[model samples]
Target: MAEDLNIHDADPVEEFLPVYGMVLADPALYHLAVSVGETLDRGDRWAGAIRRQLTHAVAAHLLGTYTRLKPAPETVRGGLAPWQLRRAQDRIRADLAQAIDLRAVSESCGLSVSHFARAFRQSTGIAPHSWLTGERIARAKVMMRRKDRTLADIALACGFADQSHFTRAFAKNQGTTPGRWRRLMEPEARHATMP
Candidate 1:
């Protein structure tokens, strides 16, 4: 069966079932199968429900195996789907003032935390936390343009814990403290407003 499916030793499948070819190729379906397997292994109270889901997934996999030999061009191989990426970005941007919950974001995209993190990094060329930090810094820069907003306000708004935490992160990324950056931007802001 494995030889027919072209699956090798390195493939993620443990049992080498014929239907696994289609299921493993599809990330969402693969995740569901793995989750169901784990739940069954743990002997969940809802074992019957989980087993029914597993049956359905296996049936779908088998149907797909016979029906679709060619892989979809848009199918996720290593990275997130466009819609998943957009959803994650939107979720992250929706509440920059609050601490980012990676698990929540991953769940929102119907992915496990580890898989989502890997796919996200593969797609964006950076880890999710790094991306979030970059976004916070970008937002802080924009907020700094306004003289009325204090550094503490910018920090909190950008999801930093406090002024000191924000200062450390800002300096690490920008090579200057938040206060200095603000001071540096003051001239630019003044020059722009003057004309």
Candidate 2:
């Protein structure tokens, strides 16, 4: 039918018919088809435009449903390939003091930004930014062990904008300000340093 209309794009119904068989068994598809039929039967002035619009709508619906029903390929189901994950992680860790550009990281892994983000989340169970923030926090924790290192120094080293930013993020993640956290860790630091 699309061919008769000189449409070069593959017809959604024809593409999925072999796998899904007739769509009439699906109530939504059945209702849509019935409605389109009735609209055409009425032979109103807007029939031509309505038919075109509804036909595309039906095709889009079928395509969406087909994608939802289809299982992702096994290799991609678990998310990014091992090499991609390693590359993305290494890139993100290469310089914690610098702002992370997700676009650059995704490109390094030969993926689009959205795809890389989704796959990264699937592989690590967290968004890339969240992972980066966690890493920053972890690094800040280590730096806090050195009493000589001021919160401002640690914040700059961990890619935070300033002491305030570090304090906010630390509080959000650890439920305490960086100063309070350092105080809390001071005892541990003392114990660990004692021979």
Candidate 3:
């Protein structure tokens, strides 16, 4: 359908159909669509004016999709009984800096420690200590990206015992040292335009 339209011919009408189709297909085009529309409209081309309108219309459609895709906060309302586990998870997440007792977490869920340990593992696919470690590691990754903090500070903040512990844990989960991981995360000059 696109080739039959000979959109590459650059006739305003020909350009309109394919460009309009693209706008309809992927409306999250950042500013590219708007800029194209403005540039075309400024040229005083009839097709350009039509394109601007079509672009805006398509943009509106994409906006709706984008808003819908905004990830909703995980909620416990109207869900399975186990959804209350979210509260327990949230509590644990909040105090990631402190030592979490599996017994206490189970009590929060109103389950016996042993039962909760098993069920929580079944629900989340990992033991509570493992899950807690993963969450702390994830938080540490975020901290490592900023220039202000030292590795020692990040380890302390994320509740690890010390630098050696943090390094070993980070290596186990990420398969690389923290320094190397941070280096890899740095942008190459050629890809500077990326988000």
Q: List the residue pairs that clash in candidate 2.
A: none
CA deviation > 4 Å runs, candidate 1: 1-77, 188-195
- Which runs of model 2 end up more than 4 angstroms from their true locations? 1-78, 188-195
Q: Give candidate 1's TM-score.
A: 0.55
- Kindly list the per-residue Cα lDDT of model 3 for residues 1-195, writing each as its tens digit: 222322121222211211211344453564556656567636567767777667755554444343211212233333214454676677678887888877777777777777777776665556778778877877887788687999999999999999889999989876778887766665464257657
lDDT of each: 0.71, 0.73, 0.63
Clashes of 1: 0
Clash number for candidate 2:
0
- Per-residue error for 123 in candidate 1, Å, reads 1.1
After TM-score superposition, the amount by which residue 142's alpha carbon in candidate 2 deviates from its true location, in angstroms, is 0.9
lDDT of 1 by residue, 1-195 (tens): 333442221222322222321433577667777777777666666887887768766655754444322122243478988789879978987888776789999999999999999998876766888778867887887788688888998899899999999999888876678887666655555557875
- How does candidate 2 score on lDDT? 0.73
lDDT of 3: 0.63
Name the best candidate (by lDDT). Answer: 2
Q: What's the residue-level lDDT of 90 in candidate 3? A: 74
Pairs that collide in candidate 3 are none
